[model samples]
Target: MHRLEQQFIDNQWVRSRGARYLPVMNPYREEVLAEVTAGAPQDVDDAVKTAQRALPAWRSLGGAKRATYLEGFAAALTRRREALVRLSSTNNGKVLAEAAIDLDDAIACYRYYADQARRLDERQGAAVSVEMANVEARCYHDPVGVVGLITPWNFPLVTSAWKLAPALAAGCTAVLKPSEVTPLPEQALAEIALEIGLPSGVLNLLNGDGEGIGAPLSRHAGIDKISFTGSNRVGEAVMAAAAERTVGVSLELGGKSPILVMEDADPEQAADWVMAGIYFNAGQICSATSRLLVHEAVADSLYSALEKRIDALVLGNPLAEQTDMGPLANARQRETVNGYLATAEQEGLRVVRDARHRQLPSRGYFVAPTLYRDVPLTSRLWKEEIFGPVLCGHSVANEQEAIALANDSDFGLAATVISGDGDRARRIGRELRAGSIWFNSEQLVLPETGWGGFKRSGIGRELGPWGLSSYLEVKHVIGPSHG
Candidate 1:
């Protein structure tokens, strides 16, 4: 058994003060893979104080110098790529291919942020245009000081990289809390930091559930900001905690995103995109396009095609080469998804594919990829985020109706549009209310583009330049013109 009873703090692996230990399960095998320490509020205080102490020196190093550390992180990750891929697959119950993709995304994020950090040197003391002739003003982007980063169980290192890379690139020190359920993959980050000789207390990794680490970290007086990626309920709690000190906060929360398939779209192609949007990563993505709004003319054909694809999916051990999908991340997630399926049955929604119609693995937390058609807009299945390989959809009369239906949800995280006419798809995509919209394409996310949503989907953005900005505080210096 892999037992990790220590926390990474001040560049040292020290035993946690808390006595509680949580089991890390291999979801595919339905067995305990490791036991990790659950940190206490005292641990949070220690992490924050260490980060605070390190911030001044780390920030004073300047952004260009900081870029070298991020580059080192990327190189270290590249060296351990295969090992991390297998570890994430075992811990997260994602297919080996998807785990590899997650690692690649994490490595790319560090490299991208390294470039951004170098650019920060050029942008330092940038001149600001002012109305007064006698005034010369320049703006500086200072590090936001010590921050608390909380990442969910779903994407492991990927989400942590999204928050941590940019924070470090912006010259900020941080304390990170990975989900207790899937903490195995994230330990690699701390190891990488140590291997690269990242300055002591530059990044602290704490393993615990929401109460033990996340809550206290968010409320710590020493933390200048909190960046969290998780549920809406917890995001609100983090915001409330930040409000106590008027501390900065960046939240990436839930999504019940929609995909619109236009009348002219090919059924097979549309089905493929739809599956990719919702079923990738076992549909645990925060930007998962779980709702489908297909044109009435193609609804039947698209549904038929999607059903066939779902049936053809290979659900088995994530480490296996032939597996297309794996179990839910944990037993709790499986229960949550099963609860939604039960709700669908009570609502009398038409089930195109589900456990009743398909076979699942005999053991493990496996949920059959489910698809429901003719689902009412009022149904909970249509309105809520099931967060599994569950898809709910209905037919719309035209493009306007499709756009309306897609934008009707409380979420605006992501959406997809497919059409034979490229311009038409683009037009429809623009009308949808989401942070990211794709037209006749797969959901390809790059580190250069911003990721966040309008409405309740999230507050502020992550990734790209916006991500770097989240960890910076702007200051303007004004003086008499030299001329």
Candidate 2:
């Protein structure tokens, strides 16, 4: 039991005013890992005030100078990479390899955005109509003052790092509230930020439920922009809160992403990737390929191959080196996945693999992976974001039908098209409404590519230059005639 009790506000660890607090549970061991205070609406006021106070100077800092601090932060993270990996594995219930990769990704996000901030600046002007040379035309990428960030629990460290690194890179002071389920890492970052000379109040960390800290943060008048990653329902709530203040909002929401397997695709390779697409992180990823639609001609072979590979995967303690899969994050998540499995059976979908109830040590939460076939396009398991180790395979008559099925969902977060033919791959990838389309691959997030969703999936995006730009507001400046 690690005792950590502090709210990093204005660059110092402070105690919470609200009497409410919660236990931070380690999903791998189902033990009380830490005691965290639940920040209240009033605490949000302090955080926003702190960010507001730090904004002017922080935003005015030059790129090279900002890079110096970021470099220190990055180096600091590198030195503690091993501890981060262990904490991530213990808390997130992810395989150590996966947690290790998440930490590396955080480092990569920082290095990439640090460089971007140096190269890009908006305080200057640019060329316009040459005939009107006397006049000056320029665009500005100014910070949005205080940025409010609320990240999900699945990839708590990496995802929060996504918003924090870029928001800082853009010179925006931030008030970040990590999900209660996984707030330790973010709180830890708060400590590191203070030591790295992140500047008082430039970054604030709080722990609380959505109704407490998140709602207040979004609706806070001092917040100039909001960035959130969560379910569509919660995303809607945060957007509504931001709307109340008329602040800019960015979201990375729910996804029912599909993976299409073409007839010519390699069954050996495609099967493994498809299984990974839905099973990695125990299918909690927003971009997890929950739906698998294959060409009719190859559906049988592909399904069989996937079943064989998935069955051999090891699922147990996340700490073990041989563990390829781990338990759901908590008992509630386990119940949710189990409930979805029950519903899939009642909905007349054929459960190709009936998941067995596995017992874990009195310490942890665990669930066996599952695969369902013969599911109607409208089935709950097919259309909903299960956020667990469940995959539903459906047969498509042709490429066109596959594309239609992929687009049928209200979500448009991501899709994967597996095909040997470049033309067909391009066509399907293009037609998919998802923000991201993976072709002949899976489970890899690219730094340069833009990522977001359409419809109810999300607003704006995160990752790459796109993610960085979300923190900055565009402004046009006009100068008096020169010559």
Candidate 3:
């Protein structure tokens, strides 16, 4: 019903003066919610032009002034908290609780960057006490001109904030192209930009297809860097495109994370956290712990507990407060999940949890949370990225075996280890080859730590002061020559 057929360029809403528009649908309701203008090359050109024009002024501003601007962006975001949360739930099919957290996450990113930029410092080389007369060395970090950010629909607004806040805090301009599936948040964010008094062209959003929007933006000569968050397949494409232009790219991609339940871990608690990790957002998250590595001693009890939890999952409308899990984004996701389930059966894995498609009003897509036991490493459910409410159980003989199993995967974005003792947890956490390791908990990503992946999981980190470095370039200066 809503027409978002205008792209945000040069700090103003511009209708598709250059090209046609397309519909962005609500996966939960299986209906078109808004139309996005398929922003063309001209749009990217305009955004880059404005960004280049504003760069000198923005960079010249003091750190305190930049921090103030970031705070302004945060304040504006707070005013539309409720509306953004609702839109997130409607478009992405995440529950209200999750949607609210998305808005909170965005605010946190902005606030954190503001604080980081305020206290930012540069150091001059220490004066040598030796025979040196007068030699000076200095190192300073500076922003990398224009940044191009491409976000996924799964966590559109929140992820956008992660890239946008840091890049802007580091004094970089941005050209953001949010996913066409859930482009409303970017539109809403553009309106917030005006409220925040952000300098024109400092932050711009373009809506269009990959070739129409992403390729042009990434391949643009004026753009200094690129940041992308999405699936591995598309990530490869983005890398290739950026490589052609010889531009830097920060990629946050797919994950087949594992959860290792130590022998001493309480099965009841481990089972609860395991279910929450993968099935919380209908298991559409990249960091979903799809593989459960259980010590042989606790395997039986843990599997029993996990079976009970999945069996109790309520399959209903996401808007309903009582619904424990919603559908997998859309029909393609549903069919993909169902196909994995069918393949699980074909692979001879014992599926203990009921994964039948729960029929409701037949208006939206819905699928039950499923669990497969004794699934081999080669099984369909074990290897492929289901991106839905599907978890596979793998029983291991001991801690060593459990660690081996966890590290065997091609993807290693994140892993959760549930144990009673702190020493054991810390030891195992260190051994886990993951960007993030949660001990005695799951899926709690804080603002202070860095998050990314190893292997095919991702390229660079996000969150914290170090995250800002991703959008910055370091320069070394040697001066004060004695004549």
Highest lDDT, which number? 1
Name the weakest run of 10 consecutive residues (lDDT summed) in model 2: 121-130
Model 1 C-alpha lDDT per residue in residues 449-477, reported as the tens digit of each score:
99999899989999999999999999998
What TM-score number comes out for model 3?
0.95
- TM-score of model number 2: 0.96
**Pairs of residues at least 3 apart in sequence or in different chains that clash in candidate 2:** 29-363
Residue 66: error of model 3 in Å? 1.3
**Among all candidates shown, the one with the greatest TM-score:** 1
* Model 2, C-alpha of 173: deviation from truth (Å): 0.3
What lDDT does each candidate get?
A: 0.91, 0.83, 0.82
**Model 1 lDDT, residue 132, Cα:** 86
- Cα deviation at 16, candidate 2, in Å, is 0.6
lDDT of 3 at 456: 92
